[model samples]
Target: MQFDKPATTNPIDQLKVVGKPIHRLDGELKTTGRAMYAYEWHDKDVSYVYGYPIGAAIAKGKVKSIDASAAKKAPGVLTVVTTLDVGDLKKGKFNTAKLFGGSEIQHYHQAVAVVVAKTFEQARSAAALIKVDYEEQPGIFDLQAAMASAEKPDDSQEPDTAVGDFEAAFEAAPVTLSETYSTPDQSHSMMEPNASIAAWDGDALTVWTSSQMIDWWRTDLATTLGIDKEKIHLMSPFIGGGFGGKLFLRSDAVLAAFAAKAVGRPVKVALPRPFIANNTTHRPATIQRIRIGAERDGKITAIAHESWSGDLPGGGPETAVNQTRLLYAGANRMTAMRLATLDLPEGNAMRAPGEAPGLMALEIAIDEMAVKVGMDPIQFRIVNDTQVDPEKPERPFSHRDLIGCLERGSKAFGWDRRGAPGTRREGQWLVGMGVGAALRNNLVMPSGARVKLDKEGVVTVETDMTDIGTGSYTIIAQTAAEMLGVGIDKVAVQLGDSRFPVSAGSGGQFGANSATSGVYAACVKLREAVACKLGFDSEDVVFENGQVRSGNRSVPLAQAAADEGLVGEDTIKWGDLTKTHQQSTFGAHFVEVGVDVSTGETRIRRMLAVCAAGRILNPITARSQVIGAMTMGAGGALSEELAIDTRRGFFVNHDLAGYEVPVHADIPHQEVIFMDETDPMSSPMKAKGIGELGLCGVSAAIANAIYNATGIRVRHYPITLDKLIGELPDVA
Candidate 1:
């Protein structure tokens, strides 16, 4: 089923089960702790040993030598395999830095060796006995110091959008504002760390690992091991959380496979907490400069956004200027990004990636520009909203309602009650409210699935789609139920297996829509198959109450498959629909904060997010996603930052104890409202992603609220109390 043009009326429009608020089908397994993670896979026929990995000490250099004789003699030590023993190997196409093999140390915490033992404690204790010597070399660690050497990245996703003369338009405007802002590099810090279990059956490898993309990891793992892709199997049944951290192949799987082959036994490896920061990818720090020119009437005439970020040699830029090219109405607009070479751990996607950090700066600048023009922030944003692409006017947004989001959010949050900066007083605390617009691109990938109908009138859907706390299992069941005219109880969903048909995999806010669309395509095929077997025309064959009806004739759906079950397999292919339409999701964030006048400490009082992202598949799961993103936004605004060691070229705070995230006690009253809308251009399901959209610009709303409470402006991210302490008024 190729989705080239806009979708028309389909079976999903029935509003039977797809759009209802259904509880997650996997909730029982999670609540009862019956779901098995990567390291907990049990097999009675085979016993699993433990492999503990040792990471590289030096950031940039070559391994001089390794003395593992002491580790070999340690208790219960089966084998110790070093990188030098493995020799040179191929790097995966998606990876910027090599995972393992050879003597080169590309970054800190690069796996150098793994110690296999009879028990986890034995392997851990034996790994400490091994000694490694490295030749050190200087590497770039600071983004500001390396900005001069940064060069333009070859970006095919979105090249710099330039129109009309930005300089002339800016110079001629009556009210203009220019400011620079910075956001720090941050960690994913997912609930479950990277872990993998590998067992080889005569060169046929099977790995139970925590991976988001099954095919990508299988292909890459085969590349790293110099084996055929068909010989390796990978699956991740349940994941605690990923946030783009486990989207690719990690060292834990490779180390486990190598150790299992060496010892001729299955081995399980789990990366220690200290390695999660220094050994994996992170959201790179960015320095952005934004210039906006507007008239006294609050119409934007010119807008330019430029950003710079540092990463390993072949890594791409942070793409922090993505939302700037299309967020508001700016005639003469320009957006550019530069990538710098740094020797730090590879910088890649975390949370929302580009739009999350970009909005953190752009939205705050919008608020500041609103003040310069003497208008309310929400009104200023509403007046500048654009229904079409600001850069390319020929293409219009498929569905957009940013104005509605702001207007509705304001009425619910009592925006009119918001007063001037530092004027609203509550005992020793000052209170204020702020608003910001949210946007993230709508991405679609080709996905495939297989649907099976059993003799008992049960439908089963098979796909590699993963549920990384985004409710893939629930929405998938709902899609199949709607398509086959059956209740969700009759649909069984099996996911995260290599043998299953390939899916979009969870990332970039594209997984839910793309994966379910694949299921919908397969179910459509099954409907046709059922109609044919029952000697009925395909058109207007209404299936309901476990019966297939055509004209005055009706047959039990199970009777169509009296003995053998029917199967339908298909993949959803996409054409140039995205190119013809400017597809994106929009929302608004309203935040209220109270700051202690004397201590400069901030407390979040209330939060609300109004979203307009097409159809909501299941309101119960969608709300879970939005609230989780809102909590992450609170962390990004207040306390999340990866403490860097410049001289050492690694994350200094390598463990969760030092890395801070939001706790339940830290958050306050929160609410979310989804606009009653759907985009026919998105998919047959008519739904777009809302998880990432829930996060974009939320931090800026918090920062703006802090400024409203205390007249201190913070241009850098993680707006700590120290940035406001000296600026506090004498008596407030």
Candidate 2:
């Protein structure tokens, strides 16, 4: 099914189930601890061995040698698989670094070997016995130190964008503001670590893993194993959590597969908590410099954003300047990104990626410019909002409600009550409020699904779409139920299996809309099949109450598939609609913060986000996603940072005990508002993604609020108490 033009009236327009606030269908299983995760899978008959991985100690070096003989002969160890044994295996397409089988170490904690044993304890004990000698070399570990050698990367979204003479425009402006902001590297820190259970039967291998993209993992696993793609099977129905860490193949799955093949039995491997941060990918730290020139009335005349980030060789930049090219209206604008070489693990996607950290700097710059021009922050943002792409004026937004989000959010958050900076005091605390605009690009991918209508009037939808605790199963069931005119109970959703039809997978907030759109297309095909089987005109047939009706003639839908289950398979292929028009999600974030007068400690009082992403598939699920993102944003603004050891060339705080995220005590009440909106060019569901949009600009709002509470502006992220104590006003 091709989506070439704007969508018109469809079954989803009925809003019977797809738009309802439906509870998660798998909620009970999760709460009861019945839903099996990767490490929890149990096979009744097959004996399973445990595999423990050994990671490289040096960040960059060549292996002198690895002696695994002691490990193999110790305890109940069966065999040992080392990178030296495999000798330069092919790297997976999605992986920026090699997962296994390499003598050269690119980063610290890279998998060097896996020791298989009858018990986990034995495997762990044996793994500790394995000795390794490495010839270490000095490597770049600090982004700021390596910035002088940074180079411009080659890619479509590699920044370096300009429309007009930004320098001249800025020089002529009446008011101008320039500032530099820094955001440190961040970890996914999801509840579930990378884990996998692999078993082999003859030439075929199957893996049960915690992954976000089943198809990507399957393909990459096959590539890493040097086997045919058909020989690999991957299943990841339920995930503990994956911000963006599990989007590609990880070490656990590959190591488990190798150990299983070596031992001739099923094997399981789980990366220890310590290995998760240094072994896997993390969000790269960034140094962003923003310059804004505005008229006396707060109209932005010139805007420029330049960012620098570090990554491994052949790696991409952090792309922290992407949102500046499109977020607000500026006649003369420039944005550029530079990539520096660093060996502190492979930097990759985390949550909203470019936009999340980008907005943390850009939105705050807008606030500072607003203060310089003597205008309200919200009004300044609203006045600069662009309906058309700022760089390409001919391409107008398909549907944008940035102003609506700002106005509505301001009212709900009581913006008028917000007093001057450092003026509003309540007892021992200074209170203030701040606002930031949210922007995330809407993305569409070709997604496929298979639908089956059983003779018992049951509808089943199957796709490789993953549910990373984002309520994917519930909303997918809703889409099927709404399209088939059946109760939600009559639909079953199967997901996260490579054997199923490929989908867009669950990253970039595109899963809900793209995967469900695939299901919608398949359901349409099933409806037509039912009409044909019942000898009714497919065009005139109305499916309602589990019956196919045409002009007073009605027949039970079960009659169409009484002999056997009817199956419909189709892929939703998108056209040039996305290219023809600018499609993006818009939202506004408002935050209230209280700063301790003497301690300079900041605490969030409340948070509200007004979003206009499109027609939300399910309000309950979308709201949950928003609040969770808000919590993460709070952590990023106040605590989260992957502290790097510049001399050691690795993240110093590798464990959760050292790294800090927001806990229940740190978060206050959170509120989310969804504007009434639908984009015809989006899809048949008319819904854009809201998950990533919820995280964007939230941290900036908190930063702005803290600045309001205390007259000190924090340019560095993780605005810890140490950074504020010096600038805070002296207390009585």
Candidate 3:
């Protein structure tokens, strides 16, 4: 079913099941350890061996040769396959760096060989026997150092956009602010590592792996293996966490497939945690410069944002200026993104991606500009809210309540009590509160699902959509239940198998909206089928309480399909709705922080987020997602950083032992509020993506809060105490 027009009063508006705060459907399985991750996949009849990978030591250059003779003769070793065996294979569409089977070393920890053995310890022991010789070459590793060589990336549709003359407007403005901010490389650091189990039977390959997009991995794995796409079967029913790390097929899947094909047995491969950062994708570091020109009354006149980032060849830019072009109202505006070729690990999506880092700099700049204009930061953001696209004035936002988010958050957070920077003190701690506007583009993709109603009256929905810890199963069950007029207990959901209908598949926070819309479309067809079998006009039929009613006649829904199980399969295709309407989610982040005068350490006291992202499907899950993102934002502001070794051209701190991620214990209390609003143009569900929106401006709010507490502005991220120690006030 095509969503060509604005949605009207649909069956979902009933609010009986879809909007309720229902408990997560998969909680029991996860809590009981019954939900199997990729590495834990098991079968009764099949024996699976372990595969351990050997990585190249050099970041750039060619692998001269690999000597695996010792590994092949090692005890319990089944087989050893090197890059030389496969030769440079065709790269996949989603992959930036070659996963394996290539002599050219694009980055450190690029898989060089895989050792298969009867046990994991045996495989690890044998993998150490293989030695690789490489010819090292100097590589570009710094974003700031390579700024002059940065070029406009081809993948960015609009690498540069300009409106009215920004220079002229900026020169004439009474109050202005210009600053440069930096965000270091970040790691996904999700709970589940990239892992896969591969098996082959008569030239047909099957893989059970951790991936965000099942069909995407299937297609890409086929490409990398140089085999027919039809011969591959992929399954990923449960994932502990993704955060965009498993969005693409990593070396685990490729090595497992190759090992299985070579040894004639199933092979399981999981990347060692220390090798993940350089072998897989990471959030590239970015250098962003923002300039804002505003009137004395806080009306923004001109706003310009430019960012530079580095990645391997053929990779895309971070696009850190994306939100700046649309977040606020400005007559003269400009945005540009430059990409530099650095031989680091491939840079790709992580959580909110472009908007997350972009807001880290843009929102802080907004706060600085507000201070210059002598206005409250929340009021300054409110004064610049735009109902229409700032760059394209003719196009209006479908549903924007940025002002509402700010105003509501201001009152709820006690914004009136906020004092000047470094003025509020409690003993040795200085307190302050800060606010930032949040925005994320709402996206939709073609998604399909199959719904089946059996004689038992149980509805089963099958789609390739994945949960990835964002409550896909709960919300999807809610959608199917609402549409079929059944209780949540009566619906079963099967996901993350290539055999199922393809879905949007859980990334960029679009899965909840687009994938559920696909289920809604299939349910629409099922409803029609039930009406036709009951000999009632489809439009006049009413589905409720497991009964089909028309006029004075009522029949049990199970009776309509008693002869055989009924089925409905459909895809939700969109039209030009997004073109006509600027679809985006908006929110406001408010954070209170206390800084210690003696130690220059900052600690968050409490935080709140007011979000105006369309109709929330499940308040329980949406709140969970928002708070999770908020916690991640705290890490970004305070401690998360992938320490890169410039001379080595690799992330030095690749393992969790060296890396830092904030937990519930580290973060203070967090509250989330969703505005009661919906956008018809979004989808049949009328719900927009809210998870990423919760993260967009959170770091900046924290940054501004730290500044307010200490009266010291930090332009760089992960505001470590080292950067503030000397500037901190002395405790008398």
| Candidate 3 pairs with clashing backbones | none
Which stretches in model 3 have alpha-carbon errors above 4 Å? 730-732
Model 2, position 283, has a per-residue lDDT of 96
Relative to the true structure, candidate 2 reaches a TM of: 0.99
For candidate 1, lDDT tens digit of each residue in 1-732?
999888899989997999899999999998998988898888899888999999999899999899999999999999999999999889998889998899999999999999999999999999999899999989999999999999988867464779989999999999999999999999999989999999999989999999889989999999999999999988898998999999889999999999999999999999999888888888999999999999999999999999999899989999899999889998899999998999999999988999999999999999999999999999999999999999889999999999999999999999999999989999989898988899999998888999999999999999988999899999999999998888999999999999999999999999999999999999999999999999989888988878889999998888887789999889999888778789999999999999998888989999999999999999989999998998999999999999889998999887878988899988999899999999989999999998899999899999999988886779898988888887786536
TM-scores for candidates 1 onward, in order? 0.99, 0.99, 0.99
Q: List the lowest-lDDT window of 10 residues for candidate 2.
A: 723-732
Task: Give per-residue CA lDDT, model 3, range 1-732, as digits (tens).
Answer: 989899999999997899999999999999999999999999989999999999889899999888899999999999999999999899999999999987899999999999999999999999988988889999989888999999998854578999999999999999998899999999999888899999999889999999999999999999999999999999998997888898998999999999999999999999999777889999999999999999999999999999999889999999799999899999999999999999999999999989999999999999999889898898889899889999999999999999999999999999899988888999988898988789999988889999999888889999999989899999999999999888999999999999999999989878899999999999999999999988999998888878889999999878888868899899999999888889999999999998888888889999999999899999999999999999999999999999989999888888888899986678888999999999998998999998899898999999999888888899999999888788875421
Residue pairs with clashing backbones, model 1 = none
Model 2 lDDT tens row, 103-171: 899999999999999999999999999999999999999888899998888766555988899999999
Q: Return the clash pairs for model 2, or none.
A: none
**In order, what is each prediction's RMSD in angstroms?**
0.9, 1.0, 1.0
